[model samples]
Target chain A: MFITSIGYYIPDGRITNSDITEILVEDNKEHFSKEDIEFLTYSCTRKFEFLGIETRSCCSEENGDHFASMAEKAARKAIDQAGIPPEEIDCLIFSGVTNPFREPSFAIMLAHRLGIKTGDFFDINDTCNGFMKSIDVAGLYLKSEKYRHILVATCESPYDLKNTLKLDIHIENTDQIDNRLSGLIVGTGAAAMILSSDGGKGRITHYGEQRTSNDWDASMLTLPGTAVPGAKYGDTITGFWSDGRLISSSLIREMPEFILRKLSEWGLDAQSIDLFIHHQLGNNVTFALMDKLNADHQKAPVNTFKQFGNMATVNIPVNLAIADEQGLIKKGDSILLLSSSCGLSYALLHIVW
Target chain B: MTFDEFKLMVSDGLGIDDTLLNRDLSFRDDLGIDSLSVINFLVKIEHKFKFKFDVEHIWAMKNLGEIYDTFTEALNNK
Candidate 1:
């Protein structure tokens, strides 16, 4: 059984395109063309205010406690939906680009929050591919006769890094900070999924991964987080910085071949997928990938970039839960989950709902 | 340019209430000017004065007074 239950949360503040356009115009005389501004507004969901976000929320102003809150929200919702008590959960996984602290795995805090006393807990650091990998891991765990129920949760919040980065670096006519900061639009959200041994609403039929470290050039788009030097807590480091043009060029070159290989592994054609749920990278990247795959836009549900920014690892599950809420995915429909993370890791999962 | 006009432009550009801004207030601490807000402020100053800011000049700027001096120097140089 796969994804017996799924839940997601988006902060309440709504930042409309008009608000951004107005702010930009007043801030700078070089105004965005109305069409371009509208494209940005319609293409990505952004937060203009912090209304619904609590002080303890994952994306909140405070630090360290946000991840626990996100995990609790998603865990409680999924457990309730699955009709299982917390004690019955056998395994728990936390996946995301951002964690609240360095030690005490976010999964441990989540297990504590959910009161899942009888589960093995761990975390995966795959960023955008996190949810897909966590799903695959949980599936593998459930295959064991010793495990019955597994819960996987992913939470991402990149906004705090915005203030730390020096905004002065200019790369290709755009500030490196702005280009890097634009990645922040991939909103802050958490998603939890419940997997069971008994067959239910959905099943993961196949999984595949392809690594292309030769294109490590794509990893240039990085932030000063745990992976980088001088990024320890309270150090006040630079935020995200990137050569957007360079990253875009490399992704275009690498992703088409990656997608084709994954599709081939599933022994399925692009037309066979009833719903294509891919990573929420950005508008341009998503369009480029779909164009290469010759995917039917109708079959692909891409709200990740447009509605929730990128949410890194939370992209897939958040998209899936939104689809479930919107009635986009029905029982017995074939859904394709694909993601490409930093470190040049690519993964694909085929789920039959 | 008159200080009043420069103050008005700064107020409009930074989205600060016009009444709260004056030539006496410091941009960084008083206005809480950030790098993004400063970049936007420079863009506004360039348009208002009809001059382009060299990337290096922007990097050198630390405060409103420095920006004002730089703008005047660029104008005089032009």
Candidate 2:
């Protein structure tokens, strides 16, 4: 699939590590000692410092930027960039990691809101890798000579998930720090990409996927808390399930093999890879993967994780924008995307920019 | 919990092999255990022994013996 246009929506609300330190101080001042407060700040900030995430953006309830609204805003940008009305959109796919509603698919709601009455509208629930995977699927339809303009959108709201009444039960102390710190590291993001077979500036040509479920419950984006027990949301998990240590260790051990396998399949090597866009789980995971692959991610755009946290499905386009913003992307640059999720699903895509 | 048992959990959580389970194991230099790994490891230790040591005091620990001493003191006080 060739990329005709790319647009992204990052919430205006900014949450920094210091902001989290303030939040913890406000929420637990009465329960914690001065020493505890100092410890909490160090404990939280030290982790982010190590992970290389300084700030992130999330949906601002005060600003009225909910997940669906942000999705529409991003989709509009891509549609506008393509210089085509929503009616011309052959396929509208919503690849959201944090769904806003249950009954009606987020894609339908977004399509309706954008005044897109007719199209093959659906949702691809692939956790964080949905956007790129959806692009791979779109190529199949485009190759068969059916779809002309395939538009994929992603909207994630970790802030909204954290505020849910279900996940908001009181926590007695800092033992829950891992979950809470993970929450701090998460922010919402959305992006829209218009793809076509017209051979535009970008074309994704190769794809690979794998699942290693040995440590399935070891890391996740959501916690099975009091709000709902026994409930499951595989594609759209609430909050960020971060087994930072486990993910760091596992990705280091396995990602090199995955990268080499996919690259070899495409008759390429790590040196031939121009850019390896990765899931911004954190700085630690991304660097570990790159280091193991023996690839220099120095010029590769990765501001989304440090600046906007993990955007889930929107990570690829958003990170691409980060690359474009840095002038890292140019015509004819070889590109690749790598992603991993809690299901332990891993995907790699070879594209040209 | 015995010192050996506590050391074993740290080594396991960090994916450190048994040969590296010496008393002077440095978290950063030897194990490459970042802050998050240490937090997860400490949480696991808390679950096993049912005691929450002050993470602030223990995070700066440089060796396995100091880590064991920290937990030993926490259990003793309890």
Candidate 3:
């Protein structure tokens, strides 16, 4: 399937290190010691620096830029760029971690708002890997000749400190502070891409074989579910909890061979790929992957996390859009989109641009 | 790099004392180096040695000795 157009929207709210520090200090000041508070202040800034995340985009709740609204704005831009009427979209796939609704699928609501009354609409929640799965599924739909134009969009806003902070919870030690930092550094972003069977500048030629290990508990936004043993139907837990060490170590251990295997299986090499648009998990994971692949800094765009934090499922698409806009990508150039997420799943999609 | 040199390098990189840098000391448990730091440390080792350590073998390391052994395997093979 060919990518006809790409667009992204970052909210007006910009969060810096100080902003995150303020949130942590204000919420947990009473429970923390002066040393602990100092650590919180220093740790937040240091972690941001280490992860290479400078500023994160946060959605203004007042402006009402919820996931659905952001999805609509991004989708409209993609649709407009595609130069196709909204009704012409054969399917809409919304993938991300922060869909505002669980009852009605996010894609259905977004499709309605965009005046797309017809075509298939649904949501995919594979955490950060949602968008890749969406594109893969879209490719399937387009390849079957049943769909001509498919719009895939993602809006992620996983940095809501207020909602994530349980009022009763108190920071007891530096470890507690460390674990919660992941949620604070997360940024909000939305992106949309229109893929068509007919014509476009980029074509996803192959979806690399997916390799998955059940490290499902590694990273999670805990909510009331069957997985949470005592979590009643209405119960909820705030914040995105992740074992940063586990995820990074697991990914590094798994990704290199998986990527190498895929390249060998596909009869390609590191030199054949123009740009390795990777999941913006963090600076560490991205650089490690590039290092493992023996790819140069020019071959991969490594600063997306620095600019936008981890936009979750929107990470890869936003990177693609930014790269395209910045003229980093050229027509007929081969691109490899590498992604890994909560399922500890690994996938590579080859696109000829 | 020699083991003494490696110990000095890690001590400097992690800001820990050289006396604390023993082969059996767990970087995570004893040295207090978290997960992320371990990756950075491994990257530094790769750059310093100019050898790509096997990913699977390295993750199994719990102490400095295993790491040293994994990276220095080229010498053993040679």
TM-score of chain A of each: 0.77, 0.88, 0.92
lDDT of 3 by residue, A172-220 (tens): 5666654465576678889999999978889888786454656656665
CAPRI level of candidate 3: incorrect
- CA lDDT, every prediction? 0.63, 0.74, 0.76
- Local accuracy of candidate 3 as per-residue lDDT tens digits, B10-69: 888777899878889987546546557665556555545555556545545668987777
lDDT of 2 at A274: 81
Model 1 CA lDDT for position B65: 60
Given candidate 3, what's the lDDT at residue A204?
84
lDDT of 3: 0.76
Off by over 4 Å in 1: A15-65, A161-184, A215-237, B1-78
DockQ of each: 0.02, 0.13, 0.15
Error of 3 at A164 (Å): 8.0
Model 1's i-RMS, to one decimal, reads: 14.3
Better model by TM-score, 1 or 3? Answer: 3
The worst-scoring run of ten residues by lDDT in candidate 3 chain A lies at A225-234
Model 2 TM-score is 0.78
lDDT, candidate 1, A1-353, per-residue tens:
56688877655434344444344433333445555444333222122111111111125444343555766787788889889888888889888776655588878778887787756898887656788888878777777666888888888765443333322222232232245434434467778888888855788888888776653433333444335543221233333443343444545556667768877876887778898787765444555566667876667755556545557777788777788789998888888887777656778788889
lDDT computed for candidate 1: 0.63
Better of 2 and 3 by TM-score: 3
